[model samples]
Target: MLDAAEQYSREAFPSAKEFLRRLYDFEIYHRKTAPWNPVCVTGLPGGGKTSIFVAATRLLEDDTVNAGAGHVLPLLGFRHLTIEDERSELGILRRTCWAFNRQWSGTTSSAHEKTRLKEDDGFPMRDLKRARDTTALVGFRSGCCGVMVDEMQYMTQSTTANTLVTKSLLELSYLRFPFFFAANFNLVAKLLARPPQDRDRLLSNPVVVLPDTVATEISETAWKNYIRECKRVAGGVLDFDVDKDAESLVRYTFGLRRKFVIIIKSAYGRAREAGRFAAGMSDIEEAYKSTAYYTHRKDVESLIAMETSGKKEQKEFVCPIEVDSTEAMARHRMAQEEQGRAVAEQMVIDSLSPAGRLAYQQAGGPKPDAGEKSKGSGRVKTPVSSSSLLAGSDQFHRKRK
Candidate 1:
């Protein structure tokens, strides 16, 4: 069975879960047709690209009950798994060795020291090639059907590293081991500018772009459910007003699951510190202020505006208990009269067309007769020609002349 963390990550984001399903479907389809086709998944930071890969791979790993036809081999590697110094081809080769060896934790023993490649040992190009050969041997023996490289953006930073990584991936592709690369979408130019051979190898790879945030309804439901789950799991260690707190979280975090989790945890900590059982709106505000509110200021402001507008509408419609029935009925009648009057005014304005409405508003309602004078200024406002208004009037003379 998958661990709790992996299960939660997979279930929390429906998009990621769907992506995993599609990837699996593609894998099965490609294995029958073109077995060498790789897969690439791209997204922004904290968009759950890595989560999809982790969840998918863990599912494949933990599924011992359904020992399907052939072994479903999947391996996830990080930047550090390839080697620390990725400035050259040697570093790339070393990384391949490390990944294929599956001893990434680097627990060395004296007995195995002679056979293993030492970091400090001065090895020539031939020796490095030998290590790579050993990697291939071990990888083939281990039945590496698929290889996933997470944080692949780092590998494309330098021309040399990019070329070497591309070459390595292409070689692996030819060996029938489909590779999955996860990186930022900004690296599209670099990823496309590879050599012709690399392009040919990777061109067939399907790219999956992850959304940065969950859907509004999905997030709201998930967060409320999460609160209920927490209450049950934590055994009242943490408390929350599900509807109120979840709404605040969904709005403030703008549906970003990562930020939502961080802020809620921070708010929970604040509530605990204040000796309160429940994390409320106040704690949420405090948590948001301390976290990514400044970084995502515009989104936060928009969320605030939405909440404020909603509250304003709520207040406007709310009935007051202090008003007697007679006064309430009068107020309701007045409100209905005002609304009908405004609607009629708008209808009349709309019938006049754009030019007429402009003149009416500018002249402060309907125009007066030629002989009529203004109520306050005591002067008849005569209509002026467009050309005369553009040239010079006494009104313009004060400003221009």
Candidate 2:
């Protein structure tokens, strides 16, 4: 799979799972140098996530778990799980354990093999708790390496922060080391403003938040990042939110957080520039225009795609996947919207054009959001519009056609 991952760096393949297989192998071999917390990937339902992983090269990972007792086995050298993209938290974990047991248990070699299969007895029990435990091991390994998660919101708390999952990962991350998250725009935002401790951990990651912006106040660096992360699978469809004016995605984000996401994305640019993703300057700036989020919250969306998608590097992954190691990121923008950026004049969004404005509203921007409290600092005012400031700067100026 490692060789395939390297090969993927050259050719475009057919499925996301194949990409995942190779990418997983590459990371497993280099687990010692992996970064961040778990990766998270998100999107609307039926985003074709499962197919991506299934298509990835197999046997890249040899670590196995016991199907007999539903026990998670330690890795031979390192580990990579294609199960991060599974639907639910329990599902991701269970699938991982099952994959392991089927792979090893002496049937072929190790205890983590899934191809080994089991007797019809179902002795492993394979209940939700066991599933969670097995998956938890995947996360536990992330502390020092990378862990992938797809549809991040589904496996977490209702709040944007996904407090429970964050808390659990944080506790274990000290030992697990690295993690990743790949989820949709909104959920990624929520996860970003995680509790102080978790947020701190994620900040250390080489995040790649996507370009599904709700508004525009973003800088040019962010725009380039987005371009680097776009992924196109079998169909002509493009994955990872690559519309021209992303205001539509904004409606799903909180205003304050939306604005901040722009900055956070910039950080991703800086990180990449400084070898955050271990990529060269040309490579980081050479790919997709979107910047997929990583850090404590990277995702398997990219991983699945990396392993399962076409082998050709159609474009730089908008987010990390295996071999790539990226995700969409989650946040809690809406949970704490402010009272609509109280200002004295008509407030304009920072980055939208006339047509872009229309697109924004059309993409779910009708409802106005309440303003949000500034992080940590209390009573911070919303940004003053440039037009408003310009107006005050030269009130005496005359305006004529």
Candidate 3:
């Protein structure tokens, strides 16, 4: 039987495994058949969207894994293209063609053989736009398995780039090529903003990998389990109390698995620098406050604000899927307001003298409950409506005046 930590780690990314399974089934169905709808895996920057496709590619490439499936890869092969700085439509095409060619021709061959193969394929790399559709049709006829385009968010950097990327996607869809593309929400939003036909063709099939949220009991449990798993993986170099520090860690990292790992690693490094044997909660806090984590800290704060306020701003933190409806946004805003009131109430309570506190308690003034403690600060808090607080403040100011 698997240990609790090992089991949690294994089950941490069910979406990834499901993505791979879908790829496998797609290949099985389309190996000797026509192409089907392509899959688009989307998530936050560090949510492991790319890692899912990469793992799928590895499985597909492994002969042992493919032995049961007749070992015959489908057409288009397993081509992986990373869109870094490819700004134009032609650049995307060229990159796609290159990915196809590279996969078709094994990388182990001699340089001369590689050049000859490229020549034989007649892929007009220098002038693909001029050659147009004929070049892709001819070169890709021999067949590969699938294509995966990663870092598609780069295409949204400029208007020209965005238009060109959409054009390339439309072109691929028209060709009915089987492929997968991993992108962040910006690219997904851009595609969804396109015309009906364009949006339908490209984003009809989406695989969204979202981070674990701490809003619900089930998700919070999952987050805590994930933290424990990470701690177990750290072995002897880290010795933080998972039960005690998990909540703070979740708050610090905004429940992002990657950020959690980064914080843990940084904590370990800090411990070593301070001549400590193992990193603990103090090191984790120092790491989070360190210059190295400043950008991530800002990102976490931005994400928290966006979620709680239901206001979308283009910030460095771009993950937690869009809050769609007005009702949902209002709900989030209300929750935030309630929390703010709680904090304000706690501040007032903290300012009271001992005699004032006793008198207030005796006089039935509300006290903060244990559950009202802020997650980040651990200070007692109590809820009050924004309007009530504003009215109270106005009354106090009027009396002073």
Candidate 4:
């Protein structure tokens, strides 16, 4: 049996840090209320993606049976899934609706048939409207329903899924359950770049993205799309050691990585307002850790890099390519990161010189001396930690044991 919210503690989502605090409040409130709001946390791979549902299941199960003061029967029931699973997005919907109604939360036949059914039912989550079924999803969801579509890229582009499920999600606001769609880059890119017709479904929805905006990067609003705004948020944090050029770094490192980059890259003010920085290895790592692509970024990056770099290449490749001998493509990325890092460091340090640090404290920002410890606060972290990154890459560094 799944445990309750209280039963599941912070360790369940190690990478999420204070973020779990946000989930716990949202989950608890949704359990005892109406109009369930499902949150979609999108990010790059290795971003700690599945932790939400782990917490959700525990929250839901607790609401079902816990005797604690905070527990209550959830107005919503849920089913979680990743895209790699066989069922298409729509198929998963059908199964979820079936489970919600049965109150069993276990697998059932694919047909979604239950003896308790009358022949003319329909499913609103799937928007199933066949005249042959009696237990349609419309009635069940009229009160409570929700589905967290994890690893959403597996969501097929087929008409049944893309069109129907998309429509179903749009119409879901009428019901209590609001869908939360989270995934790595490939999946997010498909959704963001969905054709004009398909993209309309998500035009005005709320989003929270971390900084890495490649095809698989989640766009959940870690960095607003305005550089001026980012500058406002950046404040003194901008002065830090940069590995690449800030402008090019923002443009290329995670191409299309953050959905609102053009806007946020406009300024370097993050250090003052939000205390979150987004232009270097540290900022990028923090943004990534906070997005939905936790388990998906590395895969997508490798795939794209391999696809693009592998084509028309006759030369041998090496891991941990030395900075000086690296190819132009690789050099471009490093340069961008370095520039951004340098610029950010400059800004930060400039803010901290004997006189500037005092002004920073007056501005409501962390004092310059406090900068060293913020790494643990999710302000930003180094992505290419030369010392630790190659931990699992030993297989490729073979010398024939």
Tell me, by lDDT, which candidate is best. Answer: 3
Tens-place lDDT digits, model 4, residues 248-317: 3343334333422322343223322455454443343343333343433444344345434444231212
* Ranked by lDDT, top first: 3, 1, 4, 2
Candidate 4, which ten residues in sequence have the lowest lDDT sum? 314-323
Each prediction's TM-score versus the true structure: 0.49, 0.30, 0.61, 0.34
Q: Write the candidate numbers in order of decreasing TM-score.
A: 3, 1, 4, 2
Q: Of the candidates numbered 1 and 3, which has the greater TM-score value?
A: 3
User: Scored by Cα lDDT, where does model 1 land?
Assistant: 0.50
Taking the tens digit of each residue's C-alpha lDDT, what string does model 2 give over 1-401?
23423332234223444434433463443344333344344432223333233233243444543322343434321233443223344434444444333422221223434333233234234465444443434433221122333344554445433665554344333323333444544444555666776555653443333333332335233543544343222132222334543332232221123332443344446556665543222222222223343321222233233333334342333222222222222222321231233221125533556576667656754322225332233765668899878886677565431
Residue 349, model 2: lDDT of 38
Whole-model lDDT per candidate: 0.50, 0.37, 0.62, 0.41
Task: Give a tens-digit lDDT track for model 1, residues 223-333.
Answer: 567556755776664555766556445456654556656666787788889988767666666676664445653544443343334332322122211324543344344
Model 2 residue runs over 4 Å out of place are 1-36, 39-92, 104-146, 156-161, 167-178, 209-401
Candidate 2 global CA lDDT score: 0.37
Model 4 residue 102 CA deviation (Å) reads 5.8
Worst 10 residues of 2 by lDDT: 327-336
Model 3 error, position 293 (Å): 1.5
Residue 139 C-alpha lDDT in model 4: 22
